[model samples]
Target: MNPTSHHQGSQRCGLDALGQFDEIVDVRTPAEYADDHIPGALNAPVLSNEERVLIGTMYAQESPFKATRLGAALVARHIAEYLETIFADRPRGWRPLIYCWRGGKRSGSMTAWFNLIGWKARQLDGGYKTWRRHVIDTLAERPAGLDCVVLTGPTGSGKTRLLQSLGAAGAQILDLEGLARHRGSLLGALPDRPQPSQRGFESALLQAIEALDPARPVFVEAESRRIGQLSLPETLLRAMHAGRCVRVRAALPQRIAFLLQDYAHLFEAPDDFGRTLERLIGLHSRQTIRDWQALIAAGRRAELFQALVETHYDPAYRRSSDSHYAGLDQAMTFDYDPTADDGHAQARALIAQLRVPA
Candidate 1:
């Protein structure tokens, strides 16, 4: 682990270190918390979802004074009994770190109350928003020595699964897609989950990378800077794009089957297929969009996919791949048999190829 990642006192504790606190609480509402929070931060929202909605309305329609008046009464009502129970029989020496969305009035009030009772407490500066950006930057500013390799390929090429395979061979791999709770595309959002906040995403990335030896290169998939709702730390994205690419190719049928497996969730709600097509409208013609939407409405996902493949995915893949085609000399492209019989031999061959000096 990087030295700075471990120091909570320096206003720079990596999310991993902070996660180790005795009490890691997220003061945001359950809805806010549900939309991807730091994995372990307990939701002890100062405001309930409805209460937050009510307060937001007050802030928008009435004056800030009115909003504060409404907010205080509720927070005090909701927390008074709870705070008493939390501090009961405990000495003032317990340490806690409290944070709100922006580390504003809500968290400040809690921190002050904790301090008044003689407890050692600190308010997270700038709140969750600040910490999030810190996670992003920490990832970008690669701790000075960690070497890395990016596994580059088109959609549905089994990049994330391959990371696990590399792990079996004792290789370091960072599954960025898994970290972001995203496969890094418009259709990448998992069926019922949201991506992590940018900060949470960065913290996860940092923790994974810190576990590896910096002197040894680690494998990661090629991804755009933004992954679903979260953005990749710019520095790390730069490093990933700049790193040598290892190409993995599967025959057409195998690639399609891999896509189906990876995006199996989408098929369950097949009728909702239009959502992705709607998102891609800006990238295509109105007529093309309508035609695809019609296919989705008719429950012809196979036809819809074929339409998308012809109109969108295939062309885009070729264009994007062409631009960065310069590094082919450094690439180690390999094919895998779709049949199970050749799996081990193929895996061994790829691993052995990776063992060669880049």
Candidate 2:
């Protein structure tokens, strides 16, 4: 775990050893760090967002010499601030992993400063880009090593809730929609929180998969290749397709009730709901869309949701599930109640059933 031992000029460190460092520092600008960074890494930006933009503009339009001088000054000021505030109480043995966008000047400068101060600091080889590439590669290869149990059902059947319950009951679960910060549907967007970049989603997925034991069955909701704007890694998608399937079924009324509770946000923002519904314009007739809109306008959400399930979602689910899952029809069917307690009970029952080998 000695930082100097792994500091062979840009030699990539094993991701499994990330925990060896006392801290992981992201030296990218606030905006870049906000978009995504290594999980648990502390932000220690070498430049502010405005400063980065100013430097880039100067570098491109004015002169590289002037830009270099200005950038150096800014980096010095920021590093001084970190030393005074964030790293003020650090011990002599403090070991930190530093990274920037591409392991270039920003992280290098910080690492040099830390080394001069006598604390061991290593620059992440290839920086954030390297870590991102690792995530993409890991996701592409890792799922094949897992024993996945794919959960398939139409919308509003409480699949996500069931996954949570199962996880709480000691089952290994992969919540892809959660990692993507989406619900894997047209109206799946969470309020205020935007979905992560594709790289961010892959990073989260890689970490989640890495934590699971490959020998045990992983319970995961069956989803289309894409979740929001992110695409599933091909290997994970293939593993889901080939995995053993479990179908959760609920009555139309029960589904509408569950959806009403789950999508309360849609009710709070009627206009946003209307706009999202417009995405289905090509599939449903104008009159049908108008009718659904009227239901939203009239606050008849349950009725509208029922209509959507009967007309749009259920049909789409049937088509996609049958086409993708070879074991769809023969899947172990679990009938779920609309209530929370019943959902947990059903999850427990499913877990017990899964324990018996097929």
Candidate 3:
């Protein structure tokens, strides 16, 4: 049975009406809020993790009446606290959009109270589940008239950095690696920052894609089906594969220099760096792994980076690019040196060239 609504004086709203509210409040537990929520929504959980668990256990082992009674007390206390603090200094005409797991009691309780207090608050009709569905569906369908200009090359080619330059010079881009918080590689994990949950990644992806103009070309780095723990939507992969291909080229010495500068953080954390190298054990011989670790121990950054590129990154990139991207042999070339000052100018030239035609 559908849960009864306590949202009085305000109607339940669909996803279409999301922009109508001044504020979006998520009333799920803190853990749920942390997992993923609306991009700009504020978390105003009605019940905490412990209290929610207690109430659920009571509902299963005891009676619904008892569970409801306990939940009501907890919800009342939380709402009272919010009124005194989080929602304290609100203006008379303020509005808020509230949601929970579904259009259920947790959010309804807050919505009812907000309306009674003279602030118009609306409950999301089907709650976050509705928005999640929209994210998935939108990502699965290719946007009409969308064109992707794919940047392809081996690692350390400054593709990501160049994409940023392109954006600075007024070109559309989708930085999948940036969104995933993973560098799209085994070693790409940021030491201090962790990757987002798959759902969170998709949410950000949809928002970024939606912000682009479909008539203009969208520049994106060539990638495999997956970026870290998140999988690229098949529709996006199709668009990327079918788009114009550009190979970013740089000399070997510059590539090594770029890697050294870009990944300087790894050098500071020796133990973690050593352990990360161990992941390549099966791919490389034990002796090769030992040599790489020794390089780390001796602080031989240049030789170590050079060996890694020649042995691992370059070969793998060749195989993947050949199989995944189209028209590589005939791809347009963009020379980029990370140490050079002409990057933005190069990006602008490429943009003009891309606008000319295939």
Candidate 4:
């Protein structure tokens, strides 16, 4: 028996054994892969999304024999295509780790084909499900060991930009918004980009945290549990809440100016902007909503934005920050001028401060 193929029940070997392979091949449908997969794994699906769905329906409504026949034929065709295109250039000694939704037929078929063709391939035991469980387990304990510094500020205070600047200045930073691909606010969604799946977000977060030094303080933005549709891991959220706090302070005018520049897409797409405001109808009066919509129509965005800051975001931010962030009132305050450059300079200064022992 092959030493690597230590198949006890369904799993080929331990999860840590994944690093031994030349490549990780995800044989699940594209949709499943997109939702979440092993990081750095190549997508060489043995079944398309529609095909998987159709086969599943047939298995339930028709007969297992019929479903198996169709699925086997489709899997064979996909593997043939992969050999012709993706695997055509692969050398004889290439070894791959193959996985699907659950180390089932999809991954098994791919691994069998690769092995039959003179290359050694192993199937991931329990597949993506096992990998996901490992992520969840790691995250549950990962944050407890890291020293964290939480950066706190209201909306449009340039927290995300400053995080980038700090990262450039050699500071360890966890950019939650960047990972989620959303700004963590009502109007925070990017125009063309969609947020990652919940599992994908967790996977990204786990990898980022693992890369950081546990001995040094890692800087991260203060956020509520959720960033758009993605929820922060509970252990990570607790770590941020317990960390030392640094507040980024800016005047209303500066914040508004930064927001205007940052959210320029809203002006370009008035209808979408108006639709976002519709979420606020329950909180604000209908007249107020209409008035804000009118500002978009009249191209008076600055005034409209100012009103949102004063009436909505500021109050909510203050209340949340005061309650959630420990020692927030006594946090080291870093102020900046109105421009983006000034925000970066502030980040550099903060980095300098962090270098000195408290």
lDDT scores in order: 0.67, 0.85, 0.86, 0.85
Model 1 residue-pair collision total = 1
RMSD from true fold, candidate 1: 5.6
lDDT of 4 by residue, 47-149 (tens): 8999999999999999999999999999999999989998999999997989888788998888888888988788887888888888989999998876778
Best by TM-score: 3
Which digits, one per residue and each the tens of the lDDT, describe model 1 over residues 129-165?
7666665566667644445566666655666777666
TM-score of 1: 0.70
Winner by TM-score between candidate 2 and candidate 1: 2
Q: Compared with the true structure, what per-residue lDDT tens digits does model 2 show for residues 126-177?
A: 7888787777677778898877788888899888998888887778899998
- Cα RMSD (angstroms) for every candidate in the order listed: 5.6, 2.9, 3.0, 3.1
Q: Which residue runs does candidate 3 get wrong by more than 4 Å? A: 1-10, 143-145, 356-358
RMSD of 3: 3.0
Candidate achieving higher lDDT, 3 or 4:
3
- The CA lDDT at 211 in model 2 is 95
Between candidates 1 and 4, name the one with more favorable TM-score.
4
Taking the tens digit of each residue's C-alpha lDDT, what string does model 3 give over 1-358?
1333435544687777777789999999999888888899999999999999999999999999999999999999999999999999987888898999977999999999998898988889888887788887788784534688889989999998899889888888889999999888878888778998888888888889889888778889999988888898888888888888998999999999999988899989888898988988888999998899999999999999999999999998877844666656679998888667888988888888777331
